[model samples]
Target: MVLSLMNKDKFLHVVKVSMESSPYFQLVSSSDAYRAVPPGASAPVRIRFTPSKNRDYCHELVCLTARERIVVPIRAIGARAVLNFPAQLDFSKCPVKVSTQQTLLVRNVGARAARYQLRTQSPFSVVPATGALGAGDTVQVTVAFHPLASGAHCGSLAVCCSSGEERIHTKLQGEAVDVIVGLSTNSMEFDRTFTTMSSHRTLFIENKSNITAHFQWKAFAAEKEENEEKRRQCLLRPPKEVPQENFPEEKETEKVKGFCGDHSALLSSMDQEKMAKVKLMNQGAIDAPFTCLPSATNLGLLFKFAPEEGIIAAGGSQAVQISFRATVLGSFEEELQFSVAGSPRPAILTIKGSVTAPSLHFDLAELDFGDISFGFPYTQRCRLTSSSAVPLTFQLRMSDDGTQPAVDSVDQIRRDSDPAWSKGIHLHVEPREFTINPSGGTILPQGHQDIEVTLCSNTVMEFYRRLLVDLEGIGKGVAALIITARYQPLPGLPQALPCPGCAGCSCQGEVLLNALMLCQLDTRTAVLGQQPVVKSTFAPSPARSWALF
Candidate 1:
């Protein structure tokens, strides 16, 4: 606050101003103080008051001059500004997917200016929600209601002050009513799809009215009436063509009055006896005249729509994707409802498709390498064919046994190698017991893949491995090959099976067995921990001939 001081006398004079020192009162124009107050000219002193609390303040202002000392009193008033906001607001019965707004009057009742902010949740919003109002000033706030569904929505509006840490909440209530919407297509027809595969179609939802439209695809309830009027609710219409009204007033059949001219007492007696007989017939068990045919099952599991619930803006369109997937093989025909909030009834969508098994197979079920020589490598080839309409990705792995799932045991002794000397190799001795070239690959429709499988053994063991064929994308796994191979120690490497890097032995033509790695019967046999010796000049005694006699 600035106060003007004047030197009323017509003489050159100096004036100094000071105020009582306190936390709430401070001098703003210190340079102007203790200055020469020219004759007939005025001087101003500025003072600032910062209120620490809501209370009144008083201070003394002192002025010094050459003639006399003048004293003045100052007071700081703390009048808090108040904004009045309503306790509750209601946007009654608004159209669904449409926005309805109302204006509100907010007044500042105090002698000071106030700034406030307003906030709320979805379906309920405030426009120009934040503002500053002068003392006794009133501002208009528009509260809009945009609901997505047909129901009552409740929320709270908060008004917070910029100066003080105080907030006021106003309870908000709104209701949404229904409206008519249009669609590009009402029924969907999916093509024939493979089992465990999907076929997709798209339909457009048109919100042609002024309001936005929210929709959901709700499945029909079980045990519904089979009336023709009810069935007509779910239908397809051309663009801008409105659907038939669902609740049409049925024509009531007028009752016919029975006033026959010829009436006999004896005939009336016979009719009463017939009525008694009909009551006796109802007392006994009655069989149904017709058979209960099987109704179509709910297709929600196999038929689906992407973005099952969403909102379309006013005068806008949304493309909804429809997908059909089945796990079993059969033809399917089912119907469900496409319900828009505030719509009289849901639009019926018919989905029809068939699912069959995709044909994929191997030429040979089992790959058997019989009597494989030890310390040697053997290789074989097989073919995989695909007659499916769509391409398939496949991966090969050795099963734990002949049962379903298994682990890959390579770089040890079992299963096929992760690909011979394939990836991330370390210091390894043997090149696995089994290995397959191009272990994993893709096959196009009506295509075939030729696989090369190699077996290189360094130990004496029999393998009864089960090769598992895993189909990617569509996971229909089948235990493929029953791989049977054996490797055992021999007296010498056969001429047919040649070993190139041997120190003492050479298969130039054939190698003769001069020594045998044999054990004495009395000492030890082919036990786990026993070792045999090479008896080069061995001649057995004839004790076995007497035992045979």
Candidate 2:
């Protein structure tokens, strides 16, 4: 509240300004006695009120002057429902994938009940969506923060009362770090001849701190379930004739299974030619039986590491060997997780590369249509080139598979079969509407072909679709084209006008059009000139003003 004082005389001297007698009100600004106020000038006093009960509060601002004494009254009513929360919840430096929780309290200080709903953004969630509190009742609400990626994440948690009378918000902040074990490289690549020869790469694991760190490492192949299913289906199909050059010699067939003498011997061998032959023989044997080896369990067969597990001294580093051999010709991606002994979070390193064969090649991994307006159609094109020496036949089909994993709700995520509520967004794809030109055809060696895909959406939402391309005959390779799109509503729709006979309403349509045009012109001018444009006003008719009853 502001208390204003006006001096009508030539000059007024303020002796003191005090609120010492009032317990509920206090002056927020420092007051100076003997301050001179010039004639015809005003002075303001700022005061704050702190109410302890839900009742009328009154206080007096007393001013003692050389000429006279002034007393000003101030009054306010305390609210019934008060939401008490901290200004911010700081979960100082947390490890990645770890969750931390904080509690907020809401109290009802009056004679009535209060109902409130809690809302927060991604990476932050409340336990209960809504709750009710009786008179003099208090409830606790839990706010959780779970970091999905390594970085600084922040958002807000808001509590809104049902009466729309009060809204309280608090900032949520957390930093995710994975600094215990530092890796030399997060990614590794293999040459095109991965199937015939084994490639070796070394990664240095260094302890970032001065403390002795005990670390454990493991390699996991991504999309194991999907890869298993694809492998099973491929094995069930008819076997194609193996090329003579690609086939293993009959003499060295028995040694394929145990070609790598022992883990230690294999790690010590420096003969690149012998190891290449061993890898080629093992891959040919696995392919001959129409069986694919799962990379997850076959890591031991493909790779040999010296000192697989150990402890690193303070600020020490160790070099670990990572060997790669591809049993099947395609793209392979794996994740290496390094975890400290006592830490709940692990640092992830990704390893990915393609083992190219004599087959078709696509330049892009996925297609993004960006944002499109509802009822509008969009078309995108991609090229497929034949990298083999022979002609390749391919078939194209659209898949109505499940939606991709959503990272938006990383904090409130639950299992699909969990009893908790689940929200899913699905995209409908019509085989007839999503057309591909020259759906199935053959391309000559070293030749290229263009494929066009047209998409349209009738709803304003995000969507995801997959286009599966299958190569015919010998290779029987499969490629997936992930398509994503977001549709939005058109802009610049007319707003609702006031009732014709209501107050501030004008019956003349020209007046309304002129007002809108003026507003648009002012906005455009302001944007172009980087300055405020003066606005013109239209006086309302006297009849319209009198229509308010």
Candidate 3:
């Protein structure tokens, strides 16, 4: 038997010995595998003879061969590839490639390793890197591409594997970032020295950019100056064919001075939120919204003054005086945004100040009144009187000391009404004593004693006899006893003796010596030179005996 194998096909040989037939060996050749048929049709050899040589001997030999037809279904072995970036990458400068040696990570996700190569399309190239990756193994690779000049870039990395070719395509898109630079107009005058001034501005690269932007700050004395003819009109205005040219001789108005003029580095790394902190400072004396290197570009957003940014205490108000240098002279506008970071509302602050008003109010403070006393009534009067000014009517209310009463009375002491000359008058007096003695005495303008009240009483008596004198409105007053009290005792006994037995009498046991006598003093007396004398008389008590009486 002979057997051979082909590139993609298999061959087999078979030998069989049949026990029920004449013993014989047969051979078969495999050919035209696509067009072959079954082997069950060949008949077995049969031999018949007389039973003379031996007692009916029978034998069958069978040869068997089998070969499987090779029919394999090839399958690819990879998953979707991914790329991660820390920040937004500039597609114009990034590396990309297609299937040919694309130096990037490749991994096989199926049960086997993938033998593959890399290639690239336009604007991309693959480095000298190749890899055969297993199910989970990743390969590092390098790709180089002349990034897109502007706008979005797209391409694909084709992976040619042993099974077949699979495409892993990638697209990169980006936007152009303008390079920003800082500028300053150190000092500009509103008065015209030149008919027009032009600022030559330059730019610095930022955010990995190659873009350059040009700006011109043209100071026009008047609107008509923009069209005025000049000997250097060709330089001032670009040639029709060369509109991109820049003229530096147009006298750049110094530079727009910053808050801290020399330290422009403070503005270099500013973000959109931080650049907002820079503004048209000291605007009242200048044409502000100060022109920067990128003139029309809104690089300087309004400063956001948050309620929390300035020291707005729970009880105290906050005043933000964003100071700046006097960089130029003209009417201008300064704007700031007052906002809360996480809040949706925004406030605009447009303040006006001037260099002519440049006096530093270095300190601003407050007067705090904490925990004041309410027990005692107090009046603090500040009097600023202009002599020529008319006298204003003041209504006065009375207050209390710890021991006094609170009274509200209108005291209209005018310049013409009896008493006039005085200042803010606060009076504290004892409580009212109208029943015992009249209170609240007033003296005229000329220091003179006018009215005096006398109160007299015996040591044993609780009540006092009062005498009152009124000299309140008396001018050039003469001191006098305008009122007096005279004692005129009625006709009565001069004295009384103890009567111990009497229910309401004194403790002494002596009986009443004499009944109370009434003494009479007559005003119509006869004697010319004698003072009036009392005439004594006795009155008898009805309730007592003669001895006791």
Candidate 4:
């Protein structure tokens, strides 16, 4: 019971409160609970009554102020049934059209018997919808979930009593899922690729269900399985045809199992030519600079798929690329598996390719800068291509003498000025001169790198040198670019004007054009006044010094 205490006096006053109580009654607030009240102001106080048995209970609340005293009565007639129930219910992740159930513990925790009526909407139902319980009685109420559609859904379950006069509500929600997914194809084949080169192919994922699905790419097959397959193939092939070192056997008899007496004689005459070119390179040899650098790599790490994990929407598709790259020389094959939610089994994909040494070459084997003009730069555009499927890591070096490795002798060469744009070798002699832009770098598989080769000379002399591309991981072969040019002073113009008519007059572009033509083409003029060459004459070009740009 609660009542307000008002200060009837025209001034401020303090109100004091006291409760005459029983075991079933309580003072909701401490005595002196409502102390200060301004003139014409009021404050509230409360008294509580609780019954331990089905019997009547009463309590008195006394309020005292500076002006008056009052008494407030608090009462509890009887105890009715109070319930104990779960705060909320959840039916986590159930398949559509399927039923999932959870129990709701309903108990009568008060003094009297009670009957509960369960009510909720479709896709959710409660068992023993109406049940009576004695005082302190407990029942296990079954709540079933029937998902009508995919995705998250919500509803409410009502526990009603006394014609809904007293009721309790619990939340209802669940995740409805229907997953169906697959791949466009079950197998893949890669192109023949060179070692250290990357070759890739694309496959698609198809989601056929109404709900979104998650997918993952994995390599499920073990190396032991691959060895078993190799071993089986070894037994089927004849000893002479099989690569003996590639597949080892547990028993020695397996190596010569099917080899008859005459077949053993065939093995004795081993092919000496097969191992003929296994000699180490000699640095002193003239062609030593053309040799490629060697490389090593792990085989297990050779194959990989891009965009490792992702989601696929309902009735949607995604494309994924699988790539292969190797550091060793031989044939290689690897297996990959694709697994997704709702699929009974993972999809198997095979990746197989051959890895050979890198084969890199320029479009042209040589660059000829015919006639060089002093103080002017002659430039040539060159394209370096990787024919094999592997990358080409290289070093571009300029050679004074075409027979030696120039990259290692960089410290021995001296230069007063270095071209800041030149990446590798920068030093050049008075006339054996050439510089490369982006002197050293890498090239992608089946890709090309564009570079500019600039040749310049200050002295009048002939120049002969080579530009070497030392490719990494190449067992043997040459990537050499030969350069040849001769520096010549511009030919002097005739002292007398070729056109006699312009001798005493101001010189025009025609006179200069004719003089240039006479000096370059060695043409003798025969009174061709103000007439240009029948065929167009070009200026000195970077490609050919005699032909102009």
Best by TM-score: 1
Please list all clashing residue pairs in model 1, or write none if there are none: 178-342
- Local accuracy of candidate 3 as per-residue lDDT tens digits, 128-168: 43556665676676665554343345565555666344445
- Give, for candidate 1, the lowest lDDT window spanning 10 residues: 275-284
What is the C-alpha local distance difference test score of candidate 3?
A: 0.29
Better of 1 and 4 by lDDT: 4
Ranking by TM-score: 1, 4, 2, 3
Instruction: Give all candidates' CA lDDT scores.
Output: 0.56, 0.54, 0.29, 0.56
Candidate 4 to truth, TM:
0.26
Off by over 4 Å in 3: 1-105, 125-129, 142-148, 170-549
* Regions of model 2 farther than 4 Å from truth: 1-80, 179-549
Alpha-carbon TM-score of each model against the true structure: 0.32, 0.25, 0.18, 0.26
lDDT of 3 at 508: 31
Candidate 1 vs candidate 2: the lDDT winner is 1
The predictions' CA RMSDs to the true structure, in order, are 34.9, 27.4, 47.1, 37.1
- 134 in model 1: Cα distance from truth in Å? 80
**On residues 57-85, what C-alpha lDDT tens digit does candidate 2 reach at each position?**
77777788753477877778555566666
lDDT of the structure predicted as candidate 1:
0.56
